[model samples]
Target chain A: MAAFALGWLALWELAARAGWISRLFFPPPTTILLTLGRMLVTGNLAPALALTLYRLALGVAIGAGSGALLGWLMGSSRSVRLALDPIVTALHPLPKLAIFPIFLVLLGIGEASKVALVALTAFFPMVINTLAGVQQIDTTHWEAAANYGARGRALLQRIILPGSLPLVLVGLRLAVNGALMVTIAVEMLSAREGLGALIWLAWQTLRTEELYAVLLVIGVLGLASNSLLELTSQRLLPWKGET
Target chain B: MQITYRIAKYLKVVLAVLLLAACTPIGEPATPTPAPVLVRVGVLPFMSNAILKIADAEGFFVEQGLTVELVPFRSSNDFVPLLLQGELDVAAPALTAGFFNAIARGGNVKIALPLTAFTPQDCPVVVVLARKSDVEAGKYASPAQWKGATIGISLAGAQGLPGYVVDLFLRQAGLTAQDVTLTALDPAVQGEALRSQQVDLLYAAEPWITRLLAGDDVVVLSRAEDVAPDLTSSFMVYGPSLLAEPEVGRRFATAYLNAVRQYHEGKTPRNVELVAEYAGLETELVQQVCWSDIPLDGAVNVDSIMLYQEWLHDLGLLDRLLSADEFLATGFVEVPE
Candidate 1:
């Protein structure tokens, strides 16, 4: 895969150098490599990479936590799910970004709004996943727990929750991806820093090569984060078969 | 379950650290470089990209011994920090130089050359609509008071420039941003927003404005250039490194001037092709972005810069307003005789 990607890069550079693709449509890879090299050497990537990861982490943490709690409650209780599911459906489909002006008015165009957007997007997948995990708990396990005097917090925590772990992890992974994307989108939309902001900055200035470099940076970060999350889930749920 | 909860708790701590990092301010503030050889150029899509593409594709850059790179941006907000980081060579934003220069003291790249100058047709397009009852009022009521208005701007700069200028125009008669609530929409969504009565005013660049005006129904409120005559629709500026490179800057300028001459003389074809490709639109749409009636050479406009300086001061966008001479290099304003 790396070789293929590198080959693509070489082809692009050669095409640009050889005057095949419009250099305007695509600048040479050398320019991108040089720009990326300078940025890496100068340590500009640290703060941006750090900031993007931070937002992704915060959003996923808060969003996933609250989502799991809510989903568990709703899934364990039939009545609550019946009532709240409609509300969730109605709200989730509404464009998350339509509220930018409202946020600008209330939150004032700062980190609060960007963070809020990430959290909002994150909450959806996490909640859906958690609900699936909780709801799918085997009925036989509930009966078995009941036989042993398991009920309330103990039954819910030990039997029901453990059974739902795999489903919940699936949801969490989705939320993690959403969290990163929302952070970039919001930061790209407004905010003073981050990788998304870097991508946006490159476009406005017409640094074609640098633009691609920003994207490459984002791609690597995204791939690393997802793979890390996947590995952790696999390690923890050793018995779980792949869906 | 207990293990999961513990894992979640630990994850929260890790995530918190990352969130704060994204928000943390670091690196050198935007400022002029000690010296530079590389002519770092940042470009917006379409017109600016096309111009740069022409310079690159047609041996213009090679002729001038210039090395150029094109950067992609989703919008103007992304450009802000990039400009601040001194990562770009030049930035030709939809906004003026002062707004960018103000966000940080040193990291901000100042405007260099005005690669794009415009007249009525070359700038962003804004149309004001009303109930037939209101237009018949004929008293020119505040656009601010025109509640339930839908305005299309690509980003804040798109909304900010026209809305700010027009708001002032409306305020002269009695109004504020509070008076009329403006919903922001991108150009692709503008037509639906307008047709649905989701918006009363639509502000975007031409072909949209041109198509809207071509329609028999919608009323043209005012042209962008007429509203802000001294305002530049878009212009170019080198980042610190690019500005500091005398030879490259000089060569870049010369090539840019020649390209402008070719464009004006109708000697270029690929310029349009590049503009279309960069804009993620069709070739005809790119062709529609004709060089404004004003000059296209990379000559910095004094009055436009001064107007931007005033806007920045008024918007409290600057710590101290820098003079045109101070903000720009000789390469920017001087068209090399």
Candidate 2:
């Protein structure tokens, strides 16, 4: 896979360098790497990366916590599920980007609005996935827990949570990606410092090398974040491997 | 079950409202249109777009039997492609290399009107800002001290208006591109960056420039007009569809010129109020900043545009240089005798 990717990069570099493709629009990978080095040495990359991560972390935490809480409640109680299903179904289909202006207006065009947009984007998938996870658990598990005198929070902690852990992890993994995407998008739209804003600024100035470097950074961050989540899931759910 | 039904009913209503909102135009005609021609105008929420906003707000477009749909863009660079693709009937973009490159690539958009001309008095539209601490510390105090100073520009290289203006200042100061460090920073964050001491200087635009100047930690170093007086910065471009329909072009030019005339009446409370409402700035700030000179007849200086194009071509950013006659649509706005 690495070889194939490198081969593709080499082809792109040749195309750009040979003038088959305009270097003004898409600089070669070597040029992008050199630009990346300059950005790092100039102390531009660290602050932007740090700010983007900070926003993503807080946003996903807030969004996932609330989504999981609500999803679990809706899954456990028929009444709650019935009431929320209609609203969730209607909202989940709406594009999160479209409501960004409203968030900007309500939260002010600061860190708050960008964080809120990421939280909103992450919220939907987390809720939907966790809800599906909870619903997929057998009624037998619930009955067994109830027969053991495990009711309410006790039953939830012992059976419902553990049983649904696999699916919830999946949801969390998905939500992280969603949160990162929203974070970058909002930053691009209006931010002083972030990877997305860096990409936009580079594009506007016709700095194709800088643009590609930033894009590569974003891709690496996404891959690294997802891999971290997967590793955590593996450690926590050791029994899942056996199953 | 009853609660669930009620919630579902409410959800249905909300969904209906959202769908209806998605279908509605931003600037719908007040009177019912028997058959109104829909004109999608691509615009940024900037003071330079005061004429377009006025035309919409004052029913100038509606009076011409046009349903002007204002499509807001974050940057003019984002909409030039859309204009070429026929998604936007008209666009007012700052004369940047991106727009010229688009035109060089056979983009069908034509310069229909000149938007803003800079003068010494009205040059606050684009200005250089520096950290107050730097100024007080005697850093970047003179044009000769510009060497090694980190300058935050709003876009890549010297292709953007801010970059061009900054370059003009540097040249006048006997400095070259090697004398300074140019970082691509967004205007939205330039103020905070200045305050935090991340950048020593910033080339920024109004609203941001106005807001930065108001900050205790920032000071205006120079305005664009100081370096390049009477430099035409923005132009109104008509999409191929609009250019093909001469009647639509004529009506739009007439409506736009009407607003320009009103704006030229100069800083009346009513004009300031309209500009403030559109640019999302306070009325006081809008009044305080210098307003660029917009032609009443909506005619652009073709010679100036050609000079700008030649400069970009020489810079190698433009693949092809377009002739003024090929890129500009004349006769829409009558030239004054």
Candidate 2's C-alpha runs over 4 A off are A1-172, A175-243, B1-36, B62-65, B155-159, B310-316
Q: What is the fnat of model 1 with respect to the true interface contacts?
A: 0.02
Error of 1 at B301 (Å): 3.1
Model 2 Cα shift for residue B44 (angstroms): 2.5
Model 2, total clashes: 1
Q: What is the lDDT of residue B91 in candidate 1?
A: 68
B43 in model 1: Cα distance from truth in Å?
1.7
Off by over 4 Å in 1: A1-140, A144-243, B1-38, B76-86, B94-104, B120-152, B158-160, B171-174, B211-219, B266-271, B287-294, B331-337
lDDT of each: 0.65, 0.80
TM-score of each: 0.56, 0.61
**Highest-TM-score candidate:** 2
Interface RMSD of 1: 9.5
Tell me how far the alpha carbon of residue B22 in candidate 2 is from the true structure, in angstroms, after superposition. 57
lDDT of 2 by residue, A41-159 (tens): 98489899999999999999989888888888888888999999999999987888888766655564457877988887778888888888899999899788878999888978898
DockQ of candidate 2 compared with the true complex: 0.06
Cα lDDT tens digits for candidate 1, A95-119: 7777755655555334666677788
Error of 2 at A118 (Å): 10
How many steric overlaps are in each model, in order?
A: 34, 1
